[model samples]
Target: MKVYLSVDMEGVTGLVDAEDVQPRGRDYERGRVLMTEDANAAVRGAYDAGATAVLVNDAHGPMRNLLPDLLDPRATLIKGRPKPMGMIEGLTREYDAALCIGYHARAGVLGVLSHSFMGHEIEDIWLDDQVTGEIGLFHATAHAYGVPVALLTGDDTACAEMTAWDPSVATVPVKYAKDRFAAQLVPVPEAQAAIRTTTHQALANLPALTADRARTRRLAVRWQNASVTAHLTAIPGVLRQDDRTVTVEADMPHLYRLFNLFLRVATAVTTNPPYC
Candidate 1:
C-alpha cells in the first residue's frame, strides 16, 4: 500500500505562537525540528502499517519548513511551491490512503495557531455552501482521485472539524486550544506516539474510511481585502459575489486549478497592493 502525508507546521507539537511558525522568528528553528519529527512519526507509522511507499508534502508556509536531514529516510518529500495541487500535490489514485498531519482549525476558530490557507489573506472558504477549511478542501481534492483520508493529527478544534466532516476519519488531537495563540498541549513524545498508533489503526480500517466524492462543486472564497477579491474576478470563470468575496463554478479537477491560480494571484496582489 502507498500513503501520502500532507504535513503543515502550526499544529505540530509544542507550537502555540506565530513566533514558532515564521522563518525569522526566534523559535522557527525549533519549530522546523518539531515539524520534521512529527512527519517522521507519521512516515514510521505508515511503514508499520504495511505501506510499501509513503510521500510527505510540506504544506506549511514557504513549503520548505521540514528539515530534510531529520525526516524519516523511508519516505520521499515534496517541498517548495508552484505545484499544481499545493497541499495535496503528490496525491494520486495509486495511493491507498492519505494522512493530514499538523493541521489546525479553520480561520476564526478556537484552535492553536488556527487559520486557513493564507492566514491573513483569506477570511474563509465555502464548498457547496458548507463552510470548510484547508483540510476539507484538500480532502475533497483527494476524494476526486479516490483516495481516502485515513488519519489526521492536530489540535482539538482541527480534530473536531474533521470528525464533523466525516466521522469515520481517525483523529489525534495533540492540543486543546485555550485561544488562538495558547493551548493545553500533549508532550512531544506523547503526541508522536498517538500519531503513530492512530495512523496504524486508520490504515487498518482504510476501506471503511473512504471519502465520497461530492455531487456538486461550487467554491466561494472570502478574502480579507475587497481589492483582492476584485482582482480574482479577472479570472474567466470567477464571479464577484461582493466587495470581498468571489464564487467559482467548476468540477473538482478544474476547481483545483482555479484555486491554485487564485492563490498565486492573491499572493501577488497581497504583496504588491495597488493604490485605489
Candidate 2:
C-alpha cells in the first residue's frame, strides 16, 4: 500500500499560538521540530501497516516549516509553495490512503490556531453550499483522486470537525481548545504514540475506503476585503456575489486548482498577515 501524508503546523502536538507556527516567532524553530516528529510518527505507522511507500507534504504557512533532516528517512517530502493543490499537493489515486496530520479547524472556530487557508483574508468557503475549511477541502480533493482520507490528527475541535464531515475516518486530537490561542496540550511523546497507533489502525481498514463519485463542485469564497473579491472576478466564469464574495464552477482537481489561484489573487490585493 502507498500512503500520502499532508502535515500542517498549527495542530501539531503542543502548538497553540501563531508564534508557534509562524517563522518569525522565537519558538518557531522548536515548533518545526515538533511538527517533523508528528509526521515521522505517521510515516512509521504507515510502514508498520505494510505500506510500500509514503509521501509527506509540509502543508503549513509558506510550506517550509518541516525540518527535512529530522523526518523519517522512509518517506519522500513535498515542500515549498505555488503548489496548485496546496495542502493536498502530492495526492493521487495511486495511493491507498491519505493522512491529514496536524490539521486545525476552520476560521471562526475555537481550536488551536484555527483559520482558513489564509489567516484573515478568507472569511469562509463553500463547496456546493456546504461550509468547509482546509480539512474539508483536502478530503474532497483527495476523494476526487479516488483516495480516501484514512487518518487525521489535530486539536479536539479539529477532530470533531472531521468527524462531522465523515464519521468513519479516524482522528487523534493532541490538544483540547480553550480558545483560539490556548489549549490543554498532550505531552509530545504521548501525542506521537496515539498518532502512530491510530494511523496503523486506520490503514488496516483500507478495504472499506471508497471515493466520492461527485466530480463537479461549485466553489465559493467570502473574503474580508472587497478589493480581493473584485480581483478574483477577472477570472473567466468567476461571478461576483455582492462586494466581498465570488463563486465559480469546475470539476474536481481543476476546481481545487482554481481555488488556489483565487488565493493568489487575494494575496496580491491584500497585505494582511494570517492569524493576526
- Clashes in predicted model 1: 0
* Candidate that would win on lDDT: 2
lDDT of 1 by residue, 1-276 (tens): 999999998889889888898888899999999999999888988988999999999998889999888999889999998888888888887889989999989987878877778876788899999998888887788887788889889999999999998888999989899988899989889999999988988998886334344555999999888988888888898999999999998767568778988988888878732111
Model 1 segments more than 4 A misplaced: 208-216, 272-276
Question: TM-score for each prediction?
Answer: 0.95, 0.97
Clashes of 2: 0
44: Cα error in model 1, Å:
0.8
Query: How far in Å is the alpha carbon of 198 misplaced in model 1?
Result: 0.9
Candidate 2 lDDT by residue in tens digits, 1-276: 999999999999999988889998989999999999999999999999999999999899899988889999989999999898888887888899999999999988878888898998888999899999999988888888788889999999999999999898999999999999999989989999999999999999975445654667898899999998778888999999889999998776888888888888888889989988
The 10-residue segment with the lowest total lDDT in model 2: 206-215
Candidate 2 ranges with C-alpha deviation above 4 Å = 207-214
